[model samples]
Target chain A: MSEAPAVRLVEVHKAYRRGAQRVPVLAGITFDIAAGEFLALMGPSGSGKSTLLNLIAGIDQADSGDVIVAGENLARLPERLLADWRATHVGFIFQFYNLMPVLTAYENVQLPLLLTDLPRRERRAHVEHALSLVGLADRMSHYPNELSGGQQQRVAIARALITDPPLIVADEPTGDLDRESAADVLHMMQALNRELGKTIIMVTHDQRAADHAHSIMRLDKGVLWSNPDDAAAVQPAGQG
Target chain B: MRAVPLAYSLRNLWTRRLTTVLTAGGMALVVFVFAAVLMLDQGLKDTLVATGAVDNAVLIRRGSGTEIQSGIERAQIGIVEAQPQVALGAGGTALASREVVVLIGLAKRGAPDSVANVVVRGVGAVGLSLRPQLRITEGREFRPGSDEIIVAHNIRRRFEGADLGQTLSFGGRSWRIVGLFDAGGSGFDSEVWGDADQFMQAFRRNGYSALVVKLNDPEAFDAFLLGIESDPRLTVEAKREPVFYADQSQAMSTFLTVLGLALSIIFSVGAVIGAMITMYAAVAARVGEIGTLRALGFRAGGVLLAFLLESLLLSLVGAAVGLAAASLLQTYTVSTMNFQSFSELAFGFRLTTAIVLKTLAFSLVMGLAGGLLPALRAARMNIVEALRAA
Candidate 1:
């Protein structure tokens, strides 16, 4: 049996009022994401894909319409409640691998656990498990500066999974990685989606990385273009 | 919804080890100077204020500002003690003694003509019983009819022939220093004590510098002063012993207060500037990290609080350093001319816990004020811009 939808954006609109000009980024966009689904959003720069991801993660608010994620109406929530919702239900992985420079990889993984009611022993267990899953358990004590770009991104992914959030939003997670490291990272994401049955919504510009997702959707000029046949024909390379 | 503890702030401070140490050092220097001035003022005031005799009343000539300038006829000592409010000793004798004061020149070791002035007073036989805290640490008390003298402990090492068994020439007469005594570190420590009759004859002081009269009861001080003022025959003014000492310290006390305030103001400005520079750098360096925290469900308020705490910790370091440096000044001595006595007086610096605490509090205030603008700027930053910042 399939679970309910994890995220839904209904007729959502986002606009910026720049010196008397109303520039709408997302005009009446709508979508639904089922639980345990692997969906990829591919688009060029400034195509509103990242903005749509931010709205679903509750990191940004829409100008109008409903943004329901993890069963709550995110658009109707207050700022403080939205922050709490994001802390508990949504995990974010950014393109820059924004791990705190002062904290070690283990401490970076433990960041989201600080917002939980888990005991120290339990939090440590979760952090260790997440790092092992990303295959960085040996580098737990190393600071971000001591790690390479790919290693830093792995730490960021560990931080996201440590909280066990149902919906993970990754925005250009391999944008700064080399080709070999990027392929290794794509394999890890595919395994997380297929083996662990996690729900992931990734926004990227790379078609090769997009092929790993079960469904690939294109976004351009604030509109989504879906073609089921093209999405099925592309196969992701394993452990390349 | 992570609740930060004191450890969070402390750990953050430890993370920026270099910045923390430098800022704390600067604040410490400020507190040290501030504490030194306060302690010096307290020490000077304490030296004179602790010498009061609860049952004794001092008689100064009307309108005379200091004991050095106040004198009365030798015969009037009897009449002043005969007042009804006067206390008595054994054999029904009145509890009054005559005292004479003169400024003497002295020299410090390895220093030229330091030329500090001190009071040399003549006390009667009953004077020893009037002050119980006085103890002769060396030799014997001066003989009542002989040209011998006792020196206060503070004056013993401060001049030539001030110790016991030493002889000195004063007022054209040779006198022997027969004893050394300690008077609980009071105004009495600055004086030389001798036999009243012998002192009067040698100095040709047919008049006494002041009348030291013990009252029948301490509670009767106002009544005694009123009784003395009502009589035209006795042209003397009476005051409580503690009140008189405090009045004498007023000029120097005021000077020290102004000095302390001036130093604190100037040093606070420097401390505030130092704190501001450190906070600005901290905020500038942590742009993307701040954005991550903001995205991780922390409000702008939390980030602001964290930075402010960092600033406070830095300033506290400076305050601690300043206080420690100031504490070392406790062994230092300073000499200044007393406006009331018109003679140079030497006093030692003192550092107390209250002064240290006040300096630290001032440093914290400076830290808060200095860190405010930078912390607000960090809080007002756009999350997207901060994340995109290189």
Candidate 2:
């Protein structure tokens, strides 16, 4: 523990209710994701993979546990202050690559920095650099609808990294791309982790997508199994 | 408070042009009615105020609100004229005019039997000197103590027998319309002028309705008023001419304002409901975007402010359009009945700078009121559910 873990979840528990019946999604899940580690989470549907990612990203609160990220305990933070913390500490990439349809790629990449005190000219420079990192510099002015599915995901990646947060959590980053486009997106993400020293947590059902990460874990019935072999075995073949 | 870029709100409004236009159109109609009401009241006040002078004073019987309802007897007239504060003419005569105001039924030019009450004032010798604006635009002034009459342009144009060179028969006597005069297109343009003695003799009356006097030193008005009102021999009230004229229009103008305000309140209810519905639809349609914004670290307050800004923008567009439509009324001249005197009064539609500012402020209130709950709904959205919606 020379360098503290980027994310530490201690005995986190969460549940949902469907028509008066309580359904537990995560139960006492404990783990530490070291700084600069790129980890992939593998799980079946409804196995709390996405819920655990949300907890780490500060998008949702754990029912009862210490869900901490980047030295900040999100469980104790108010929603208002947690938003500021997330803006400075974590970047979120959704499964669908949720870029605002009305805003162009450049504007979308600049979204996170808008919450910061960065001057407009500095914001422009940061947006340009982030888009260039994602290989989307030429597509800066193109809106989401004008771009291909893979290009839109690249824009989403640029948006996630523009803040230069210590942690990036992506939920199914390439679940909807072609094999070649998925490879390109995964390579870009690996570059972000290796070159920039970013800690990444990815959730996916695709084995090839998970193979790009440095470490792997699986979630089953609200419990975490950290064996990389168990994670690899859960992945079905012929899937990206 | 940190705000979303105004462009975001502007672009959202542009994206849903149809709803924006429809909601803003309803607001425009409400603001139009509101502005027009204020203009109508302002126009009425202007017309009446223009007929009076700052240095002149009008005397009416105590407890009478207007000249039409007041009577100053022949004896009281001498007492009022003998006051030393009255200005003098070159002939050493006092600049005082004994006036009688009476309402008579007069037919319009086209419809002879459909009559409306018109104001006809009888003036003593110095009447023409006191009103510098009144001019004999067409013919000679009326000779005092004769059956001769001079008609104002509005009365001559709108009434049948009040025309030049015609005789108007009323009170069992016939009066010759000798001249047509103009009173600078003021409230007096709706009145007819004739000899006070002849008018009183024909109507079997001996008292003047009011006395109009010019003060030698305008600063001596208080002393003059005191001299006239405090006399034991006279039961009269005196007011500076402009003040008296403003008082005359107060009741009528207030009624117009109240009536317009009530209607605007009713229409604003509909406009507010329309704006609320439009905002609710905007929130419902952008559920995914809302969640995306939340995930991007935007606080709920930012989301709330963005929606409210959009609503405010919609209402402002409506306000501009409404004010533009109301401005067209400036070219129109309208007539309504004066409640105090029961006579037809004509005035034009008017607008002022203060009125424009007030109208815009009113629209902002409506925007804030209508957008509150819908914006709160958007801000309170659970991020997980919203992202899952689309």
Q: How many pairs of residues collide in each model?
A: 10, 0
**Which lDDT value does model 2 have at B230?**
81
The model with the greatest TM-score is 2
Candidate 2 falls in which docking quality class? Answer: medium
**Total backbone collisions, model 1:** 10
Instruction: List TM-score (chain A only) for every prediction.
Output: 0.93, 0.94
TM-score of chain B of each: 0.91, 0.94
lDDT of 2: 0.88
Off by over 4 Å in 2: A227-240, B133-140, B161-167, B173-185
| Residue A167, model 2: Cα distance from true site in angstroms | 1.6
CA lDDT of each candidate? Answer: 0.80, 0.88
DockQ of 2: 0.61
